[model samples]
Target: MKITQTRDIRAANRWEIMHQVLEHSPISRVEICRRTGLNKATVSTIVKEWIDKGLLAETELGKSGGGRKPILLQPLHQAGAAVALEIDISQVQAILTDLSGERVLAREQFPTLGESFPQVYHKVCQALDKLLAEMPPSPYGLVGIGVAVHGVVDLSGMIRFIPRLGWRNIDLRSLLEERYHVPVSLDNDGNLAALAQQNLEQASLGPEGQGSEALPQSLAVVNVGDSISTGLITNGEVFRGFHGFANAIGHHTINLDEPVQCSCGKYGCWEQYCSNGAVIAYANTVLPQPISTLEELITLIRHQDPLARQVMDRFLTYLAVGLTNIIFIFDCQAIAISSELLSALPYYLPEVMRKMVLPITHVEKVVLSRLGKSGAILGAASQAVFQFFQDTAHAMEPGQ
Candidate 1:
């Protein structure tokens, strides 16, 4: 028991040291010790171990504070890589990123609308094959693959259901892992988007303010695409509730009089009124000509068409209603709306705020998501890199 405890502690220390280096490289051993509160000996020993393991590299000397110029350290980013995939109802997009989650290759994608699981699977595999072939040479090669699916994903990575695609009980993780021979993480698109947004917020803090305490302890991300879903971050962690379905706020009923039913078998759900599809559908009903896409609706609104303006006004009203409910329930530090249409219109936010019956403080908390459509994609890649470090840490023992 004592031996095992010692090993666990050692592994934890290694993880901490490595995390600090990855976040603030090229950082010095002395700076790491100062920031992490780890002793000089522990930091130096772990740094040496990682350097010897080919995961870390010592770079040029940093600026001198006083006596001696300290040698800076950086992660060997090319030592490993991760693949991130975003499985949308209409398409599948994939990107290759380094150990630091930096893009290593151009984005690859293929359409998957109305395709069967087998067809989608084959296309995904082909895309992966092309990506792998073009991957730069590395020591660890592909460390893991992270997938973002729009649906209810369980703790074990089982996709319980995807309402948009009619996919149910798919073990995508196991299938991908079996074929690729690497770790596969499957998560809800909203959850992954929230994760990516949180990381971006943390990174914006810079080195001195990069820790969790410096950022909001609770935040929420509302993803508005074909449908509406939400991701919550509580105490600086993704809040996947007991059943891994905590933040499915799209299904939350916001209207009782509406006749339209949601995919989840409910009337007047939030998504039915506030999603991009909802906006376009409503626009088509009110406009002279039918509009099939959000882009068309946006163009009409840009031209100051009276019907388009009316549709957007109603959309904003419903959007504010749902957002107000979210704020009342979660009381997050900030609520980020991830939508192409919403982000494109700078005036929509103020309009939404005007419609919401909330205090000035609450109104200030609402803002647009900086990540846009790439949130889930980048989140998947970051998750893979995170898992790799975690596994690497736990695998460390007394010696090789």
Candidate 2:
């Protein structure tokens, strides 16, 4: 039977309060109420419930100026864990984390490319087994699992397509749920990365951080590797389009006259000009020697090799063009670039900024992702943690 889910306003409020406590621990109920705009009674009720559930704990008493010493609330580390797994181009990785997204254990294994889905699936299972075995005792044991797929995922938790991985129409969610017996969250890598980026930003801009009040509520996270894809986070949540493909900028046409074909069966797509693979491919076309890695190309550029400089100039120009288009379309508060190329952003950002349509403002919104490659994995685990907190039964369960 299909079960349609609806939100519980109380639960959402509880989540908000719980997140505030997690981010700013040792916080008083009055402060929580003030920050969340929740009534004192409501905050107290939720805090009591969390404490009863062993998900929150009361720390030392507050300062003496208060009438009665107010007890501070903090997230309980042993509440439960969330597992995150990712199926990338050549690897399967699993990570286990507690309620606050702190890593407890991790496992990774390389699955031979071009292998059958089942073979790759088996490899993922092995990594998960190892991760689970290494987890410590906790009240909530593996409450949720989040899977990150390197492709498009549908609402039904099916991997619809992944040309790079040769995966199509695979029911990965069902396969894992049947074996692991936990709520599973599935999303594309780019979307997960965006979530992680947002989480990172929030953490860094906590209540104590200077200018925390001025942080943006929306962002555009771009991943530029084998393919250029983007993920949009607006109003503190992901913005999935009708087809759950809002950020397929890689397939956007940037050069109509170009002859090269993209994996998406399109000519002169944005990725063809801006992706790391595209850079190497373009380098191969101009340089007599093939540039196998970005590091090699960067090294050549550092030495001012005429051929390397020419290829890099073109790559940067194309990257600037693509980024310019993104700025015009999203107009988001920030555009964070996520890739190994992030290290090089310092060198090329000025050029990219100069090419943008908008005038440079005092706000430095364009930057690099702090989480880097780990963003996707962290985001996956965070999704599971989100589900865990949202589950009324699980979140309210008292300690056994």
Task: Output the number of the lDDT-best candidate.
Answer: 1
The lDDT, on a scale of 0 to 1, for candidate 2 is 0.78
Per residue, candidate 2 scores C-alpha lDDT tens digits across 65-114 of 64788888888867788889878765677888887775656566576567
Give every collision pair in model 2.
none
Candidate 1 error regions (>4 Å): 1-4, 210-214, 359-364
Q: Each candidate's TM vs. the true structure? A: 0.93, 0.89
lDDT tens per residue, model 1, 1-400: 3535777888888998998887678889988888889999999999998898899999999989699899999999889889999898789998988888856575689998788888999999999988898888999999999999877888777888777778889999999999999999899989999999888887676656655546777888988887777899999788888989876788899989978778777898988888777787777789999988888888988999888889988988988899888888887778889877787786888898889887644733778888898888888998898888878887766563
| Local distance difference test, each candidate | 0.85, 0.78
Off by over 4 Å in 2: 1-7, 61-70, 206-213, 359-364, 393-400
Candidate 1 Cα RMSD (Å)? 2.5
Error of 2 at 241 (Å): 1.0
